[model samples]
Target chain A: MSHNTFPHADHDPRAVRLAARDGTLVGPTAGLAKGFVQVNLVILPEAQANGFLRFCQSNPKPCPLLAVSEPGERGCAALADDLDIARDVPAYCLYRDGRLDQTVHDVSDVWRDDLVTFALGCSFTFEHALIQDGLPVRHIDEGRNVPMYRTSVPLVPAGGFAGHLVVSMRPYRASDAIRAIQITTRFPQTHGAPVHLGDPALIGITDLHSPDYGDAVSMGDDELPVFWACGVTPQQVLMDAGIAFAITHSPGHMLITDIPDSRVALL
Target chain B: MSHNTFPHADHDPRAVRLAARDGTLVGPTAGLAKGFVQVNLVILPEAQANGFLRFCQSNPKPCPLLAVSEPGERGCAALADDLDIARDVPAYCLYRDGRLDQTVHDVSDVWRDDLVTFALGCSFTFEHALIQDGLPVRHIDEGRNVPMYRTSVPLVPAGGFAGHLVVSMRPYRASDAIRAIQITTRFPQTHGAPVHLGDPALIGITDLHSPDYGDAVSMGDDELPVFWACGVTPQQVLMDAGIAFAITHSPGHMLITDIPDSRVALL
Candidate 1:
């Protein structure tokens, strides 16, 4: 969790992946592997893969699929050169019968041949782009996690996966919000543009300070809360479905990929 | 300005221009030629043309130059194959010594050898794109002119041409505002994306119901007021400087050109 002295903070994606595998880096992967895509990792039995794939397609704003692994395949060649689905992610959350059973650094001991790995696009990519464009991201500036809320906006039902959408909020001045929308629209894979802004109550978020997940950042009097669909929705959906077993990267602890951020940008 | 029974409403750009030139179309040219570029015409003597050109370059959002004519030239071939700048606009505003002298149908009698014409892009181009994308434009839907206000935000001065920026307001729900920003960003030649949103007081506008120019439309309780740098700015600047003599298209009465709307779109 140390932001200052993390040894692998400035390393490349491959090094970051290796460090995670070797147990040297077990913290959030926010600042590591700059300019590379970091993905949310989801592993479930092959029997549930098809249903989840359909769910992702139905809810792209929340769960944009980056790559999918064949059953029992540890590496997703499309996402990385030498990725191990069981160990490359910094932290893993094991769910049993829809409840979080345990949080671990590696899931190698529980790896099964029937497991299918799903790599999903994360907001970190677009955040990097926003910062590069000189737009201030409130959470990053405050050194806190972007606040997330469960909205009344329901996702399209596909198979057994169905749940209300979860969105991450960033506070910005009106002019900055417009520019942020334009900048994020280019990276559709990374949540794209904001789904809603201005009134949090419109989306069923009762209070801005009390987020369902992540820490809430401060909002200025002149700033409005802009919300983007979060990558956490699929995990929430899986939990809601009461799946027998599943594995996912712990929130904010992503799998660094070899793919450059520019590859995913529309223009 | 009968919205239902305009003979040249569905006509081509050339036909609309011909109607204006022949004194058959003396009303506003909002829907005269669909899918064609409409411009704000500014005609001034050669002595002041260089300063105005520099002003346009300094502030692109408010004054996007589409074409410029040679001194005393009656037509700009770059904008249309057959066109007459002095008589093609539906209405002309003759300003004498920084004051509104009179409104006329044509300026052919006043055309001089030392006069220069500047064609600036208008918001009609992007409004077409927004409607095609299924976004509701409040003013367009209510059949009222877009409300414009003079803001405290100053223009980048060039020579003697300088004035506060004028902006057009459109009220939209936060979600639509984001989509509108994305759509307008593609047409930078037509004022581009909004300069401000949410607060009118931040830009020095005190009242939403009473605009400095144009009719105010109703804003829903959930809507945010989005502001764009307006094309009326150049004419306002000319008047503020008290130029000896100048001719400009009257508000809402534009010059229809042969250039298609698609050509001005960035993507």
Candidate 2:
């Protein structure tokens, strides 16, 4: 895709998704959907969808559900007027019998009649808010993915879905951390507020320099690492549960929606 | 004064202050005026009042000015209809040449023509908010003073007033601390959000067990020490500057205002 042709294109999330849907944009959707809600995509068989939905409801801190599509449907009108779940996302990961089978750009080939699609809220919605409020996002500044860590804090079990809570780490100064907490609290759908702050060891993460996923950003001498529940949690839980026939958005490749980020703010 | 008589007294700030004005109640104004704006009293000679007012404006976090009375004024009608500055408070501290001269139940005896009174918002307003939100204040639970410490963070200088910032400490679990920050942010008059949290040593305090002012409350392993800019800051600055004559409320004996706490919330 020609970057120059898409001036202020990212500001309109639907436009960005349309470009992705047309196979013209095949990059991460971080800055692409500037002011709209981007989501973590999860597709499961109809038999397991009810259990996963209950899991999200019970463990809202880690899995804030934004939208859920009807069984065998590939569109979610609430998120976007024409959001095609099979192709709107930049990339998708396929899993079979609880193991990674292949990574694909679209899932139209293997669309199952009983498959249900769930669109869970992602941290990008709150991060956009934090940046708009003048708080610096270190990962964005470094042009890297937000560091994700699997904490010892276990999620509340629901039927066949159960696993430890996964968190995204962002280093901020004490004042910035306080402001971040307040900013994020407004978006309950986006994993509102922070799960833990200050020491990483408190949540069972041993090292500050190493992250289970994404690149490690610098933690200044005066800064503390603030952790927010990540959407990667469902993926981990699904893998751990050894579920058959599941699909998730590739890391950083979110499913952009028409829902403005401001619409998701509870405040 | 009989304690049983003031049953619904604390529920209404105006009623509580009215009781003090009528000489019917003269004791610690802590528990008596709940959900009301209690204030730190600072009465200075008109010659020094403007400088002190400038001092407060510069160091708002510590000395958030709620209302200021004109020289020789006995009432701040904006705060209350029958509020008498001379006798509305439970107790007053009379200072002479930067030295503690005497403590009086009422300051009507030392009233001066050039005296100007300042009613700065107190943490009691926010404490009520915290408790209402189900966060337990350790000092209030232990029936002790909220531990206060003098920090290396210097207040902005105005005229002849400048000193290290004084902070009141409240320990809470990390989650509760986040909620406390959100709750207090609504009331900017009551010092707004916390100034610093976590390590006391980061702000130059050596020990959490021994505070520079007020009694020390126990901190649990799961708790993080949160600090808010204290109203005692002005008193400390006055003491440090060695002001010739100044009158303030005695510790624990604040000036109960007629303003309701809900009125101070920015939201």
Candidate 3:
């Protein structure tokens, strides 16, 4: 997302959260509170939280954990001040028996005492770094969602959770691809460096134009389709595992946390 | 080169240098003193030394300077305890008006009082790091010299020094290529990260199989040709500029230094 998308967006994470809580700002969170850390939300029942946490730990590239909320608790104090897990996200996805049930603005009405909230690192952090470093992110330039593919590359299975890896693709020329690798390597929390580059078929991605998820962006003949582990992988894994109930932030509608993006950089 | 090529090679840099000085090691210095820094040598008259140094500074990726000796000095104490500019290399190349004059085991006889010695970082250091990290070096595996090419990419000129950039190619699968980039980035003293990968034509290299220097190693269908600025760049630049007199270590016959490879790593 670019500054043009959020010309009057609040610069404070608290303001963004308050807007979400009041049902006043109900759209994608991209470019809002620009320097703050935005995260992917996943809420599961207490019975499945441990297994899901193990899954995230095992597959860090796709599901790098930022913070975990206590069972039945709404406040994630580590992420932000006055944060409410049930209402702070711009939009939420409620799932039932491996299927998406509904997309809602708030989940307070459906909040459960047995639920546990998880915050996973999002690629927005590294994309911001890339743009700042004068690297072009094709999707951002094309005003489309980053194209994502479900690859045959399997994730290390953790108790009751198993699925193929899902990756987000961004096209870059060879030199820029190398620079992107160096820049993203400093942000391990945000997927680190690319998993595969040059060949899509090598990673079991059959078609470049037809992504399994997100909008496909244009690629130049000189560009290579670079793939990184995506946050969507966890939602797919939840569906594959046939979980009874779960909630995730709707695509592009992430949770804006008080943490600065720089704080999450490994370097 | 592999370990078998140096069945009884000395592990100590000092011992390797002693062997070179005693005329017992009159060949390529690969696989000797394995963990130490091996440098490319260049000795020129004092008249052209400053301009040559500026050229190196301007084009660091190609001519990463390790140490420079004062005019007429025959020793560089920073590189090793007893390093001699005229005799430590396994073989020396004497050039007159940029043309090959002779190849000799030592340059002590012709070494002038007005000569200045320049020691440049070589690719061997990072190659060692790559091998230690379990990545394959194709040329080393095939027992062939790393392929070197003259690219259309030009060097930043200094005074009378100007020429196209020279690059060394190593083929690797995409994942291994990413890992090699990371591994090599730590050794800036070496050539650091790759300059380009994927297309040779973009860099004005029309053919990969027919390199201008060194043996052409085999590339697999699964691999991408990763290129790094080569030490031979200065030698090529020197030839293009037509310097009156100069001395360089023969190809693959490097000057072993006391500095450990790990010691040169930035990280």
DockQ for all candidate structures vs. native: 0.79, 0.60, 0.76
The 10-residue segment of model 1 chain A with minimum total lDDT is A1-10
TM-score of chain A of 3: 0.97
Residues B231-262, model 3: lDDT tens digits: 99999888888889999999999999999898
TM-score of 3: 0.96
Q: Taking candidate 2, what TM-score does its chain B reach relative to the real chain B?
A: 0.95
Can you tell me the CAPRI class of model 2?
medium
Tens digits of per-residue lDDT for model 2 on A1-267?
Answer: 654354534367777777778877666777775788889989999899999999999999888998889999888788888777888887899998888898888888889889999889999999889989999999999988889999999899996788899999998877788889889989999999998887778788999778998988987888878899999899999999998889999988889888888799977
**Winner on TM-score (1 vs 3):** 1
Number of the candidate with higher TM-score, 2 or 3: 3
Please list the C-alpha lDDT of all candidates, in the order they appear: 0.92, 0.86, 0.91
Instruction: Return the interface RMSD of the candidates, in order shown, one decimal each.
Output: 0.8, 1.2, 0.6
Task: Score residue A55 of candidate 2 by CA lDDT.
Answer: 93
Q: How accurate is candidate 3 locally (lDDT)?
A: 0.91
Lowest summed lDDT over 10 consecutive residues: which window, candidate 3 chain A? A1-10
What are the per-residue Cα lDDT tens digits for candidate 1 across A1-267?
443467765688999888889887888999998999999988999899889989899899999999899999998899989888889888999999999999999999999999999899999999999999999988999899989999999999996799999999999998899899999999999899999999888889999999999898998998989999999899899999999999999999999999999999999
Runs of candidate 3 exceeding 4 Å displacement: A1-10, B1-10
Docking class of 3: medium
lDDT of candidate 2 over B1-267, digit per residue (tens): 564465644357667666767777666777776666788889999999999999999988899999899999988886778678888776788888888888887788789889999988888889988888899999999989999999999889997899899999999887788899999999889899999888788898999999999999998887889999998899989988898999999887887766778899987
